[model samples]
Target: MTTDTTALRLYFPISARASATRFWHRLSAPALAHHLINAARRSGIQQAVLHPIQSGYLKGEKLTHHHPEVTSMRHPQCVELIDSESALRKFLHDHAAELHKVRAVLLKCEIPLIPNRQAG
Candidate 1:
């Protein structure tokens, strides 16, 4: 049988220390997941997986079902940070090098396939 490979937009929510460099860094896992879910909705990909890198964990959720409001990426390492566009820009400016590391890790994530319905 031919398998269909769906396009997925994978996002990793890192600790504040890690995301400090990306202008768009402080966005929460749930918030970012919502953005990606909207992208999936536009792209017509019904299913995808999310990995919370800060905690080194994986969670399966229906993209279409996640809340659409944006929020902060609150982990022990990232609390007390403002989640604004301007704030993110300032954070990126102050921590460009460290943000690159976050990007590198995010780039390496692999989306595993969902098992067959019978097995699942």
Candidate 2:
């Protein structure tokens, strides 16, 4: 049987898919990401990763210049965090007021983590 446990995933945009400034509460996307990251860490999330996006577009938004062939429009980034429920709850509590300024998604889902194997 696959042992599935509850884990929380948080996703937020870090940069715009363009050279122009995209604002999140008067801060640039990357700046906003930095602000959010600091908040997340201070709220007790142990680990998170910021990944630069290559070729993806958000729905209902204007088509971003996110084509794989385009190199100039490649600053957009996303940060992902996977952690336990208690820690996630604490983060939500801490950032409750600031949460509305950005497009942050928190998902409660199940994932099958690969078991680590060691060779002697």
Candidate 3:
């Protein structure tokens, strides 16, 4: 069976930090990614994945890669989520505040489902 699906990809800096509120409360890169993943799970998203890139750069930034000599630097990270179009739309709307801080792309596509056969 083929069904409609939407792929949501969120891109951000791996070492970037975000403020949670007006106060000093902040979230590290890992923490922010985890928070978003948890939110996706709670929102009934079918799948959510976090990918750490070894070398890459975002818009208006210089490319960076992992080096043994360097101890700290910013790298690109991506969070991918797949689900129904409506479900993803709702998720984006619900998490607009947090999502606005990152770059996001939504792609519409169809997913084919294959059934399993039992051995006799």
For this target, which candidate reaches the highest TM-score against the unseen true structure? 3
Tell me the whole-model lDDT of each prediction, alpha carbons only: 0.35, 0.53, 0.78
TM-score of 2: 0.54
Tens digits of per-residue lDDT, candidate 1, 1-120, equal 333332322334432333223456556333434443343345444443444333322234222212236423432111112233343344445545544433311112234466446654
Ranked by lDDT, the better of candidates 1 and 3 is 3
lDDT of 2 by residue, 1-120 (tens): 243233443333434322224456345334545665676777667677676665554443444444566543323456665567667777767766655534556666555577667797
Q: Model 3, 1-120: lDDT tens per residue?
A: 567888999898766554365344543234567778888999999999998677888888788885667723456778899998888889889988777768989998765567757798
TM-score of 1: 0.28
| Residue 14, candidate 2: C-alpha displacement in angstroms | 4.3
Ranking by lDDT: 3, 2, 1
Higher TM-score: candidate 1 or 2? 2
The TM-scores, one per candidate, come to 0.28, 0.54, 0.75
Model 2 residue runs over 4 Å out of place are 1-30, 66-76, 107-120
Q: Is candidate 1 or candidate 2 better by lDDT?
A: 2
Q: What C-alpha lDDT, on a 0 to 100 scale, does residue 86 get in candidate 1?
A: 41
Considering summed lDDT, which 10 consecutive residues are worst modelled in model 1? 75-84
